[model samples]
Target chain A: MRIKKLSLQRSGLAISLGALMLLGACGKKVAPPPPPAPPPEAPAPTASLSATPNAVDPGQPVILAWQTTGATDVSIDSIGPVDPSGQKQVTPTDSTTYHLIAKGAGGSQEATARVTVNSNQGMQSTSNATEEQLFAQNVKDVYFDYDKYDIRASDQGSLQADAQFLQQHSNIRITIEGHSDERGSTEYNLALGTNRADAVKNALVQAGISGSRIKTISYGKEKPFCSVSNETCWQQNRRGHFVYEK
Target chain B: MSNSVRAIYRASLIFGLLFLLAVSSSAQDWIRTGTGLGVERVRLAAADFKGSNSDAKNPELLKTFNDVLWNDLDNAGIFDLVSKSFYPLQEPGQPSEVNFSVWSTPPPNTSMLAFGNLGVASGKVTVQGWLYDVKNTASPQVLGKQYADNATSEAVRVIAHRFADEIIFRLGGGIAGIAETKIYFVSERTGHKEIWVMDYDGANQQPLTKLGGISLSPRISPDGSRLAFSSVTKNGWEIMMYSFDLNRVVSFPRFGGMNLSPSWSPDGKLAISSSRNGYPNIFVMDGSGGNSHRLTNDQGPDVSPTWNRKTGSQIAFVSGRTGLPQIYTMESDGTNVQRMTDQGYAVSPNWAPNGQFLTFSWMRKYGPGEPGSNDLYLMDIASKQWVQLTHDSGRNDFPCWSPDGRHIVFQSHRSGGDQIWSMLADGSNVKQLTFKGSNTQPNWSWK
Candidate 1:
């Protein structure tokens, strides 16, 4: 009701002003001039960019939230262009500042939020216990056939479980250690062990794990889990074990 | 009449002495001297040195020096060392005390006699040694040597080795004996396989690399300044070069694969077997790990490369291209491929100093359900005719040629665990070198 009354009053004022201008023009000796209309006002641009829980531990993820008004194009620094108003999850390895720019007809407006990453010392000391538990309880040893590096059908389920666990704990890094039985040449066994570890790594990568999160090592016939000379012991020695980094 | 007869007798006597000298000198020439039917072993006698000083350590040092010298000459495979029990009761401590008739007699007939005087004072030892031709009564001394150092066990051993080397150089037809060379091998004494170095005769065994991981296939550089071996690291199987000058492991770039069995070229470039391309192949790189180039491109695994020290133009390796691991040779540029072994599993080919033969480990009948015996075999490269040097003893492998090409050192499991053993090139005079903690893969130093 207030908006309607204001419009009515504005229109009435406009009509009275027009009538006064007409009378003045008629009294003038020269021809009446044309009345001028006011120009359209352009909208001002605005932006609001912020990080949810702006402080985080190392290798932890943070959510970036942003909103904008009257923007034809919106962009975030270090993230390229994004939607005008949306949220994104970023896992920064170090402390970072995110800048958002909203551009419109009036001009551009910018907003920034800094995500602070805690130092590496305290986190390292705390993560060791959890990492040890993860390695001891979750990671399993993958076995291989004699003189072979291929992933056997029976081991696929265990490997899948491992991959899922790795995905869940994205901040953890692991080392895949390959071993071989004491039957072949030391050098050849070393190569075979590497192939075994690489096979495991490839399986993890195929299951949507990053290669950078894993490393591989071969202990060919050198570090045997079982020293007995029998098929049962040999099978036990030929394996791929996982070690977590603290 | 009396003066003329006397002059004539003097002339005849002079002529007779000249004839005797010519005959003795010719017989003393070691190159032409041989046993009844084959190459004769030089008969040598090492007398117990007399102690000149009573420093409480002189007797022990002298006994040690005498025993070491005797064992060195006896193990040289070219000498017939007279047993000390058969030696004359009189112990000659110097040239003046050496009675030629005692050593040249029938009971223990020796052509050469070694006598010396050893003394210790204020933690220092001095040794004066002399080698003499027992048959040449007048001017019997052939070699005179003097050595002095701090009275440590190492110093005593070194002095003995030096004196023994001098004797071998004069008696073994100018071929230098390996008295001073070291054999680098892998031992599990520390609960993990580590690179250990010992004297050629297995004395002073010490660990060279304490990586606390499996380290194997230790190949000492020709210059004896670096040792190249493969160890298990977090990165993978990497070739680690241990610099003797730095006394620590130097940096070797990780080749991103299974790098093992590094063999230095005659020029110090390292040739290693790597699986960087998903197949085990030979890759040659500089000692500092630069300028890498592939030497073999085959689907089968190629490994255990040994360079021909004579020309450095050829390499011998083991390849599985023929369905089983066999010895193969190719030029340094990877051309002119030639397979040396026709059948059986042959690996670890070491070329002789003359480059005329190759010694390797072979299983005559290799495969499942076949009776196989791993033994050392020597093959004439030109004829491809091989002679099994080791018989139905235990598993014998990793045969390396001595610097003088007269002997071979290898690892044998005949006595229960793998131990380093050395034998003549003809597979005679087998002597065990190391007995502790399963030693294997011995690399004889070039010098």
Candidate 2:
């Protein structure tokens, strides 16, 4: 909820700042710069923008050069405010346009330059991830309470998600590693971990996943995911983790 | 009384006195009182040995020997080891250099003194050791031993351990010493949990398996010829055996379900907790994993079976049939089943070498909001009375008794990691055995 509110406020401020900048350009021109004699009417701002190399490969840098006269403030749309008459280098991941606006005693004048980015072919569909990586990404872990083997009510959703993934991939066999927090003895934790693994296995079976596709092993408290002596770390350590077996 | 009976009684009395002079008739009393059973402790002084020659390895080997000897005796639980600062300026290397009057009085007033000398010649190291009685000036030497081995650091340590055992046996009432025994445990030093072995004094630590996977509950065979442990394999948790002679893992039949914590009966039979029959229960089989017989037909998990090392008639295990894990013992046929623990969680039931007591990890008050710890406890089977061996240090577990029943090797998290530790049977003289990686489930070798 806080994140949503913060982002909304940020966008609202952006809109108001954009409107203020537009109104400054449209309003009466400011007094001309001090000179021996002031001009009868402020000279209308003149602006020109150009890209040194208008086309390039993805992630390549492009140079934007702009010149403006009779303008006190100058800014680019995406690149933020910039010097009135200067060249700036920018790397564009995709094809983009550089929009520069100059405002002064004269009405604001805008100039735009576009940079075309070449797409790298054959890199989109080919994913080199192994089966184990895919398994880790798709399957989730089931957690339990301290010294209790029965699955937690909060973890039911996670177990169901795991079952759904396993059901979709019928040929994949998995090993359920039951782990425990380092509070009790190794032997008792071993048994407790075993029951935890078995409990998950039973849950998955009841959810329509084949029992033959699963195997269980208990690491007891031998291996821990976190080492801190607190509940937050212990909660992470006590889990039924999944591994994909070929 | 008959005349012959009266004459025999007098001769017996004389013989008993001579026996007392040689072996100390109070030996039985000290053995009983050692290890927290009583308060009396024998005052013993160990003097630094004088190097006979200036060989290059003499200093190193002598230091190893002396350190091993001193640690063995001090860890024996029956001796009040006198500090070296109180020793006389002149130490004895041989019987002729003995000055009993100085040792028997004042600062070094010790009843027993152990002094020895080490020398190297012709690529062989020789050690001459003696245990002397400073109180009895006439027959001062109680034990004299000479050992010669190849001039190596390992050989020197072995010789020292042998000499220490000789002294311990004579003074600790015929209960053989455990100074030379080995401890087999699971060490993760190599980035994988594998079986590792170390000397009883924590020297010469080495790994026995390179399976590169998670292995738990390593149980060395009764004869120390093979190691049986549970490892995660292609087929899941199975009982895997490694032969010490072949120096590799030997194949064993895989039980269908999860099999763990394989223990060896005194007669070389194997007992394990297997779920092949639907629920985890105690099962006994031949050493080669043949003739499998399910022992416990309970409703919950029954695991960590340990046999009576002395009688081999009863098997103690951890079961959860009562809603929480507890220690239970059953006969070989699984007929006379009895629950040993009446309170909170208990597991890792290991029978003492003497077959009268069991030492296991217990949490007398388990669950959250309770103020208790998981400590090792020793309980007498007949009386159901137990004594807490460890307190407030860390989670101590998997307490296995040395073959002599004088000491126990277990794992503790006291030093911020799971490491193997050993203490006297009475829970005194605690020593950390393995410092490197996480070590647990230490099984002392039968010998």
Candidate 3:
């Protein structure tokens, strides 16, 4: 009877050891793979544009428009080529809403006009504007001369009228974007674009506009309105753009 | 061996967490050497002939002195001579009757007065030239005249160049041996940039090294027995110490990375060069590349270290530690660091043999966003004062001093392309020396 009890105790101990082994096998740790890096953020899309043409002639019209997003204060400037294009900042103009255009890190976007400029029609003042008139906008393409980073003499009178509109409506802000042709290196062109934007800013300052109200940046030799490999397209490519921020 | 080992050990133990700048906000678009591509210019005035119309019959001999000056100056590569009758673009050779108003209006980069007296058989090439201050000819400082053997056409070039040297010397500049000196540079007219020895000014550019790989940064030893330079082959790049006296080549103590920019000790006992040690720093080795000693810590970047003979054991090199490439002085074994300049830019500090002043590029920012606006400046080592040397546009760099300490050879992009140039130590008489494909990296051979 005592021998039988010893054998039964030994079997009980073996059963316990088997249970421990099964538990160890089932509890083996396994690491999960690292979470994949978050996908890159997509650039914001520009929903709409607001264009306002102040001056309109063969030389190029004062293009005032709005990206409606990005940038705090937007403004327009013009250095005319009336005489040698040397030190000629914004020709005499009468506009309320200044031109503005801005670009972020992704694809570039331009603004349409906040004021319609019938190319055939001359500069018009927006003095006593109704709510409906103030809200209306247009879309037009303005051109620049070769190597000249300024609003053409033809556009000044019109741009000034747009400036008058902005002055009347002080609640608005805008960004001035400068652009260049693709003939030169990108780095230099980028700098050139900045120069163009600054040139426009200088004109705005002289025209009694607060510099703090306008901001600027250069897109360089990137993005073109006309891609045809010709002088005509390049002329269209070099420009000082205006887009409304507010 | 023990002494060298001790030096190395001392250098290693003293190595600290040195602060150096490899990347900087003010990086030079061009590795400016602070010298210009100045070639000495000479005028071959037609021997004023005055006799009966028949007396002009023997005008060729009268023109002999003029011919000699032309050939010699041409051979010397010192002059951009327009023969009163040979320049292709001119009104057939008559220098358009020196329109002083026009020339004076332009304010010539160099001012020279050439009055020639060429008469019949007594071939006397008397060139009374005055080297004036480039910025202002307030003083008719340098004047020289050459009296050569009248009969021979060959020796006239020599006598004229001698005259040029005298004037050059009087201007507190260099005595360009337009009459004798030769240039040793790498010419890739062949597949590789081989060592080519040519006339000082730029004529007779010939290739010396036939080695298949790339050979550059050529140096003429103190004795000029062999030319030391860097070469790249299928095996690797090496700081090659070639025995020119024996026409043989041997590379010393090959480091794992690139080895170049060798500067021989004052006594020719050691050659210091840029060796790869995680980064480029100065290393001193014997002629055979034995007993090597590293002189610097892991600084950001160090290259173009030249010996200052005045200090004897100190070297002036370009270091990029302060967010820009500036001139710094360290012991030959890389200790005792000191800064040199604070304003604008400095590079390629070519020390005078006397070590009183260092020639470096000092490019100051002129307009906003216009950064490459730079000029050559001379810095007095003791006073830490700078004398702005070059004022005009274009690039001027790669300054190498002459043995006499009066002249410096450098690469200047003044003409829109790189070429060799020389000027006085006092920042005067910048004359272009080369008119061909981008030639640079000049080292003067005293021999």
Candidate 4:
């Protein structure tokens, strides 16, 4: 969705293009000096984004996370924002976006989070969805090494915890989808992905989960979360998806 | 075990100790530096060599079988030189068959049993073979093939060997698991295909790099520590060095197109292969991935280069400024470019371990529509003579000499599958190394 919006906005204004290089392409390879910087700039001092779970109805224990770029001080004006001196409780009016307010010598800036939220869908995803994620909680992407199927030692601990929770909820069966960066062929990636999922399955199995309870499939180089071809995009794409099923 | 496997096994032992010796095993120690297997999974079955064949077949090819007519089913080595006391028969011709019951059953406790025949003079050769159950010779299992005049003696040898393999494959019981070795090749499988590694039978084939991004002709380094390939990855793809040493990869430092075919510089210092100013040409780089020097400025795609360890100055590669891909050689620094074969189009040249002759592929024009036929050809650089290693079955390309120079592993369509096949260096004793997926690109690990 964001890609479509980005594309439309780019095409509509004929601006900020990446590949076609509307502006950058013209100036390069020639003596033409780069055009002067335009007076209008993007929201440069955009505020940081954050979220905090406030209410808990038996299962929703809130957690706090923030994204900050330009400021050091953050304040919540309604429930009013967090004050170092003690004001900490605030009711979430919408999906939480920690309001960050700050003052710089040159200017003043306030940042708001682009925290969009939707309640967990009726059915959990077969891969890449967490148990708590059923409540629509935030989760980060898991990564893998080139051609490696085993989960990193670092990721194993968290995966173990996830496995334990799944064990507690016996009604759930999960599918671990293996993925790979577009560095190799589709079939090879598929096999590599399968290897990765198998690794994760091994881990879950070793951590007291039954083998039959878990299943796997490799979507080799097919479904990439990130489309760029560089290492970063490859890193994002070389990932195994976790979906919780009930 | 393949000679190189033993060396790698030792090097890896050095590798384990090198781990104990850490810091030094880096480029300075010259260890292979590519990603290695993560964990060890030992399968008693894979390690099982299945031992040699049963020493039971009694009726052997006699010194006297007649020459006869041969085939249509199509198809398709231990050494040592010393005059023996037994007076082996004169060179063979189209051999005739023998019924087991009438054969000269050798004396008891015979130290040696020679059961082979040849039929060269006649328009045909018949190799009559049988499985004498020794104690049960009454119901012997017989098998043999008759070859037509056109059957190169080489095919007879191939047919004969296949006959041997059948006895072994059957007597040895199910699949020797050989039906599974892989073949590695540089295929235009994907346009701009680079050096690719696959099963000896070419099953799970995947490119080592799309990172070479474009065309990258690769050759296994002499020390068996790296793959020296030319790539456009650098800048427009230059030559670069890659080590099979690192257990994990860290050296694929996207070259600026400064690296090219990397024939280990004798002492394993520099690589030799074609590079470009604008075309696929020859160039050399430090085995350590530094100090690259362009050796050839030929306009055509000068490729498939091999290094002569003995002469130091000898470089062999295929150049096409003459219109078609043919074998060409030069001095260490690229001077004295010499064209070796002038007959049929021959390309993909690799040194025959001993370095006397370079193995290459030649296309014969006979089958059908310009029906290009690719066959393995080995030319003796010194003799100015060439020998066709394979024929009729199908195109046999990418010949890699075993480290001992005694055996050569190559890919062929003879078995109706593009699989890797091996034969005596002289092109006798052909055997399929793989039986599964189509395999190609055979780089013999040097001992």
DockQ of each: 0.05, 0.05, 0.01, 0.01
Instruction: Output the number of the TM-score-best candidate.
Output: 2
- lDDT digits (tens) for residues B277-396 of candidate 2: 666788999999999999888656788999998899999999988777899998988989999988777989999877877889988876544556889987768757666789899788
The DockQ-based CAPRI class assigned to model 4 is incorrect
- What is the per-residue lDDT of model 1 for residues B1-447, given as tens digits with 9 covering 90 to 100? 655655555555454344334433443221122111123467888888889767899878887898788888876777788888888888788887887898898677998888889999888899999999999998888999999999987899989998898888888778787889999999997788899999988899999988987889999998999999998776677889999999999998998778889988878888899888866788888888899999899755788988887788888988876566789999988898899887767788898876767899988675433456889987767657666789989888899988877778999999989899998776777999888888889999999
| lDDT (Cα, tens digit) per residue for candidate 4, span B255-372 | 4312344555456655443322334456665666567677777544455567775455678876656654567878878888887866445666777544566787777342112345
When summed lDDT is taken over every stretch of 10 residues in candidate 1 chain B, the lowest stretch is B28-37
Query: Can you write out model 2's per-residue Cα lDDT over A135-175, one digit (the tens) per residue?
Result: 67557788776677788664686678789878877888988
lDDT of 4: 0.48
- Per lDDT, the best of the predicted structures is 2
- What are the TM values for chain B, all candidates? 0.90, 0.91, 0.63, 0.53
Q: Candidate 3 — which residues are off by over 4 angstroms?
A: A1-246, B1-179, B247-253, B309-311, B343-345, B365-370
Worst 10 residues of 4 chain B by lDDT: B42-51
B1-447 per-residue lDDT for model 3 (tens digits):
656655554443332101001111121111011121211244322222222123342355436444444544443333443444322221111122333332223323234434334333444333333333323335433443436354444454455556555543443234334345656765555655567676555555666788866676777776778777876543334677777666777656666444556777666645444434434556787767778888776543455677775465778876555544577877777789888876344666777665666777655542112345456766656556555667685676657766655456777778876677776554556667777665766777753
Task: Give each model's whole-structure lDDT.
Answer: 0.79, 0.80, 0.51, 0.48
Q: Chain A structural similarity (TM-score) per candidate?
A: 0.48, 0.49, 0.44, 0.46
Q: What TM value does model 3 have?
A: 0.45
List residue ranges in candidate 2 displaced over 4 A: A1-141, A151-172, A222-228, A242-246, B1-33, B36-39, B54-56
What TM-score would each prediction reach against the true structure?
0.69, 0.73, 0.45, 0.38
Q: What is the C-alpha lDDT profile of model 1 across A54-124, one tens digit per residue?
A: 99987788999999998876877568668889999998765666766676666567787878778766456
